[model samples]
Target chain A: MVQIPKTPGPSSPAPRPVPTSADVARLAGVSRATVSYVLNNTTSVRISEPTRRRVHEAAKELGYVPHAAARSLRAGHSRLVLMPAPDFPVGPLYSRFISELQWALGRLDYTVVQFGSVGLHGDEAVRAWAELRPVAVLVPGAGLGPQGVEVLKGSGARAVVTLGSEPVDGAHALLMDHEAVGHCAGSHLHDRGRRRIGVVVPREHGLESFSLPRLKGVRDALHGTTATLTELPLAYAEDSAARLAASWRDLDLDAVFAYNDEYAMLLMRALQDEGVRVPEEVAVIGADDLMLGRLLRPRLSTVHIELPSGRDLAELVDRAVRDPAAAPETHKVLGATVIHRDSS
Target chain B: MVQIPKTPGPSSPAPRPVPTSADVARLAGVSRATVSYVLNNTTSVRISEPTRRRVHEAAKELGYVPHAAARSLRAGHSRLVLMPAPDFPVGPLYSRFISELQWALGRLDYTVVQFGSVGLHGDEAVRAWAELRPVAVLVPGAGLGPQGVEVLKGSGARAVVTLGSEPVDGAHALLMDHEAVGHCAGSHLHDRGRRRIGVVVPREHGLESFSLPRLKGVRDALHGTTATLTELPLAYAEDSAARLAASWRDLDLDAVFAYNDEYAMLLMRALQDEGVRVPEEVAVIGADDLMLGRLLRPRLSTVHIELPSGRDLAELVDRAVRDPAAAPETHKVLGATVIHRDSS
Candidate 1:
């Protein structure tokens, strides 16, 4: 037999047992059922405000928090909305959308959690999520496939909603196609007669999910055209932008689609410093019509992406959760349009 | 009695029972104990690679997942490390730091989950987090007090850490003071022979945790100095910035600290369009020393902030988890200084 040491630690004296509703009831001089009624606000039973306050105070004094697991079991559902953390740092627009979504979910009494998905991939990531047993999941990006959705459902998920370019076979889809953003920018540049275009693709990890689709869209738009497309790998650093700017003349690109406004702002400033005149020498465009785009000297032309309101998305999630076996609904969530400015 | 109405969800037939290790064992033609030994990689007992593969395959085929709660009970600890989601959109530096931290935690076999904290506050937020039963928590900002820490510890949290201006009474602290950033920016503007300094305070909610401290820091820096500080409320919108710029001359501010690089870029561009020359007529400075600031024509001066590496912070969390009874340690995580450039 393996013997355990007695000196468990100096700071943690024989640990006290975790307090329960009975502890609160004892402290409050009430029955356990009465404590529960006051705490849970059993509307059918009339509990005086003073008694409710006494129960709450007793619970607080004991540092007692109702166990979510126990509550979930009793309620026949866990009000959990799980999402995978983005593989990389997203821009402000997407960030704002997420903030809105979280706020709306909170209003609907949902507990939203973003799971770290750094080392996991594809169906494996889905498996990791299934272990969490969330009532609903809202996934972003194309990594989740039909098989992944099946795994979630089999694990007792009431709802599996995805926001990506294409719909997963068994999941409700929030169809936000990044390709449209790129296609709009490409078509706008083409209509303006800017050929020999350079597309600035971010060299950041996880951005490939968005960048690759956008690249494909640009390729589709410029197909059978006179425009020559060049893919430029650029990191979001001054040194990377400077190196690209130094080699801009040799590449001889007449125009540039610099991913989004953030990148466009970075690359355009570098090009301007390199004495390359905007629109005259090399027209530049970006996606996401952020206010920063308008602040540029040669104002940045951009693809303004309008996403579905967060309230609307929250309602969609609630509906899906209510009827898990309902037909997988697909909603187009992208409104990508070109906003012309001086740079292009 | 309220009979909770039940409906068989349209597509969901009577659900199958959740698969167990015994089910995997049956499918793999092995005993349950043998399956456990193989699947859990019990080093004491060697199993053939083929048997291990068979066990894994069987587990996968059966869609079996080990219950985290059951496993936690067996192991005497859970793998959960909880964090409150940022109240609003944070800058890139913080986002990258979070990603790195999550990756590091995952490497240490901890599952990191960011809980949405939209409408919760102080002790209320701590109670909500405790209900989820995270083994460890890393909170940012001053929302958590010593009482909250006690509540968390009482609820079985192995570690409680805070990253904010000051240390809480009973929690490990990652002491990152925004006041230092503001002081640096404020002192730099003062030293540059600029007075009547205007500080841009974002009107956005949740930013008060950062912005309010920064504003106070500026005020603290110029307490006895000849320079006068004016607080300007601004939203992150073109219209808001343009309005601020239209009345810039009337405000008669010769210098400004526009919160951070993003806001600095916005306001500077607006001021330039409004015919207020940068540095010559009105100097501008920001914080976070973002690459975007340097990409500006008159390179933006900024407060360069050095944050502790994610690996280091992860180590802190790990150590605290291991020895929860140890004295709460405080570490400074801020290195804020001014980087002079053309704009200032």
Candidate 2:
């Protein structure tokens, strides 16, 4: 048994030193290159089964793990596929998709980093992200423009995929098409003989990308009809929702399309408190059919969005990064279907 | 005026890289070290005002952004403080706290990296974490043990703080004391003349740390009292909650202390749909007084827990890293108070 060193002096705590390939090599009675070859699973290395077993055992015993950044530096690129921070209030659908994406990336041996570029508005955010040297970046908002795309490309980012309504110049596009989500809700509400629709827009920063397009779709759907779109800017605060619900009669809206299930739930509860009967006084519709919505009394009607699987997206990013020169492609990653419930 | 190179060839898209400190130094007629010192704001540097201004101007003109990882490597520690993945069914309260912490950390010049260690059980998770060599690690769950603590300590992680109900053996403990959250809810229900109280225990894998302790606290609160305790193992899935709510009369529960606001919202909505009157038929209470709870009709009563601000925690970590021998202190980071609302 190899005896590890004792604890350090009282004055100074011993630094936990990571075991290198050399350390593993010494323990396995093999060369450093052999240890690296085995750990990295290099196909060219033709080693005996016993040797491979010895190397594996030594690594496990020594608690030797590969340094991700160091490996990335050596490889001239990282397997890290960074996703720009979700600029808006993320619902369960987005959360689950992100979680799944992380899992998928893990399976593909890529670390997924969520870079919160909140203060970074416009091209500056792209430039800052590029400096990180991520192989691929997935922007989930519309703030990224042509200059931003160029900045990312200039910094060794082989692939930049934007999940938004419009395609970013010089980058692969994964069109989420928020307009479609809005259209699904708008058309459904209109079909149910509801006019004078009130679309709730969040009064928070960074959500404009989603809200603007959705509002546009609502307007587009109501072009020929007598239905007029009213933009109700609502804060996430409970007091704000309560105030709005208290004056619900003054608005005289037949139906309201909340941004998502969260806002819908928020508004619905407030309306109930103010003695406003749902579906009778005001029909309510929301997007992202969250489970909590179904649990509500007179269940929340919603636009169920089926997002492209994160595993598939991760695989696509990997392929794109591996071969950047291969034809740039656009894919529709979000599909919306209206779920009729008691509320609408 | 410096002429920017047009975009590079297909094979090498980033030919003319952004100017480095050396280039900045050349432009400013100063040394590279001086440029670094000026940019980093090192007090030890003795540069005149004019020289500093010149260096700054040169850097600004050339768009010379400092490399984060290089600076970290040179300093022998990363600015990153890794937060271990929270258990599944991470509610809005935790989500908001994390978002706030990230914002606060950014303001303090610390980059927050969240490592999702879900499905990565025990020491393996710790090993996975050590790969990044974060200066500090904040474990938000109870799964990590003494061996895991040792692994982090051994890997140059200066401060290892565990935020959970119990004190972790070798690490600094930020005791959330989740049992107190349960007791707070139970005691409130008891005050409301609730004799038969049921507490929800989520059947999901990672939530055992939180759910079990909460159950114990509820049971402990009712000892020798007229109040009787019942354990309800409920999954986060809607079907499970709906099924449980449908057979409400069979359980004969007067009140329930759902683990958190998220679960409370889930179950309350389900119970309401099953024609159960809230606060009359089943007085429900939840922990983590989320904003949405207040928005609910007959607003959900909750145990509002004030966690130690992330800024304070971040400061503690920085201090601990600087002085490891500073007698390890366990901080009570989480405290519970019942926020009386319409639900109970």
Candidate 3:
């Protein structure tokens, strides 16, 4: 391939001119209001079918699209569905769900906007979100409360959906029982004849909502049996995992249920580096059965979490928005199953 | 241990009332407009210091925050920097960059919104983005052209930044220089006395912009050497990597650049499963040096990329927005370095 010579000038010659709605209206032999009505699809404006067709064709030729902010201002709400910002590095499970959610929302003619509501909690975050007058708000965190929900509703947010371990009052809840995932992992290890199990709890700020509940579930599952539970605080950092694995003998754990596959892979590799045999010395189990985990040496054993499809959730949100008085519904959004592999 | 009976009643009592802007305004003995001006720091609205302080105190007592969407609409642009949606199952490199970008934009009072612009390419995507009237738009894909840039600019977008191998004519380009990344990996393998290298190109949709350019860079660097370049199409899927690794001997490649560490790890584990010796027989290198790469047995060598801080870019966009006539500036925001380890 020939290398293109670097140009010895400014980035571009000049900015290109943009055609306006007025230009399209003029081309279609209609008023600017007619063009706006056709483009914005305002049901209030009655225009002839031929005029609408002409305006649309003219818009296509001129490449004229309605301005979003202007349209939003007129409608008093945006077609944007604001989601709670991810506070931690998203893993495959959350990433895939988010991607699917965006696709689903896009299909519903709603733009998905992810906002990091880390520092702003409860009502402060809700008020901030409400200002956008988003048609819908999907809060993945439990930071939002009943008051927050009311604030969002007052601001014209038609639907409020919260995805967490518990339900929120007055909001559609997509409960992802973290305890069930932990119970699945602990039971799987116990059934495999491993009595001493270590459950990794992420020592990160945002993950507490998930890790804490999961730890409780593990303890609950090991209640009557001789199986023991050990809590291991693991960070996402490699050095942290390495330090933890280097002194694994001191911990005296036979099998470990790493919080998720990402952390599981990290700890497993760290253990291998320290000359510890996996599955033999210490069976490793993880959540979120990612493809990469299976590609590892002594393929990673994981709890496969099947999350509710974004299409289903999106349809529900649309339905809820259309009928705000509809009774709030709760659904189990995440269900886990153990995928047995070489590691466990 | 006792099982907590699942309560059929409400999980928690209704939350206390949240203070609104009107409440703050009333408490401060000021108009709602003045409260908005003081809270949002609108330059056009002149308020006395005493009144501003009173308003601030009232808002603090009430825990009121100015609505983001309302403030944005009144200001004629949302303090939102929209980025093209991320392809899910994102590796550490992109994840780190996104996190950094969000933090940076937050510092500049701009909420970073990740919009999935999939299936919506070029001007169509730009039009969709323009509807939000984001102060700036950052397209991370190669599909955005001059027309797309112009559409954003026409819709009052103050700064349009495109991150890719090639620069868009009307937008300020932050060139990633993928060729350099590829060259760095290829030359390092060559220096290690390996020839007949195969570069793994991801068949994933969003990655083509980076992977294709990296392949060209590898070919360009190996022009005058005995090292012949082999193109290997690899998907992120496990079965795909396994299929490619199953016929590894026929390919006869000594060293392979597996695009990024995620893919490198995938192929490395697959090759090892098929009894191929790494480095000793087939040296392996991946881009986007991640912590997990070093934890692998024999470790994985990788190319590390330093992205321009999101804070710095946010500041630049803010500056550009303040002065729309400021001459557009192109920035080389991506820097690369090789991290040597056991695999290569």
TM-score versus the correct structure, for each prediction: 0.88, 0.87, 0.88
- Tens-digit lDDT string for candidate 3 (B218-335): 8988999988999999988888888999999999999999999889988998899889999898999998888778778778999988877766766667766665555666667677
Best by DockQ: 1
Worst 10 residues of 2 chain B by lDDT: B1-10
lDDT of 2 by residue, B1-344 (tens): 11112222345343345466798999999999999899999998688999999999998777676665566656767766777667565666677667776676667666666775545678877877877767788888778888887777666677888888788777877877778888888889999999999999988877888888888888878878989998888888888888999888999999999998888988888898789999889999988888778877778899988877756766677767777655455777677899999999
Q: Which sections of candidate 2 miss by over 4 Å?
A: A1-35, A46-64, A118-128, A273-275, B1-67, B273-275, B325-327
User: What is every candidate's C-alpha DockQ against the true complex, given to 2 decimals?
Assistant: 0.30, 0.22, 0.29
Model 1, range A213-248, lDDT digits (tens) per residue? 889888889999989999999998888998999999
Mark the 10 consecutive residues where model 3 chain B has the least summed lDDT. B1-10
What is the model-wide C-alpha lDDT for candidate 3? 0.80
Candidate 3 chain A least-lDDT 10 residues = A1-10
**How well is each residue in A1-344 modelled by candidate 3, as lDDT tens digits?**
11122223433334334567889989999998888888878898789999999999998777666766567766666787889776655776787778777888788888888876645666666776776778888988568888888777766677888988888888988888889988888888898899999999988877888888878878888889998888899888888988999889998889999988888988998898888899999999988888768777788999888888877887877876666666677877677889999998
Ranking by DockQ: 1, 3, 2
CA lDDT, every prediction?
A: 0.84, 0.79, 0.80
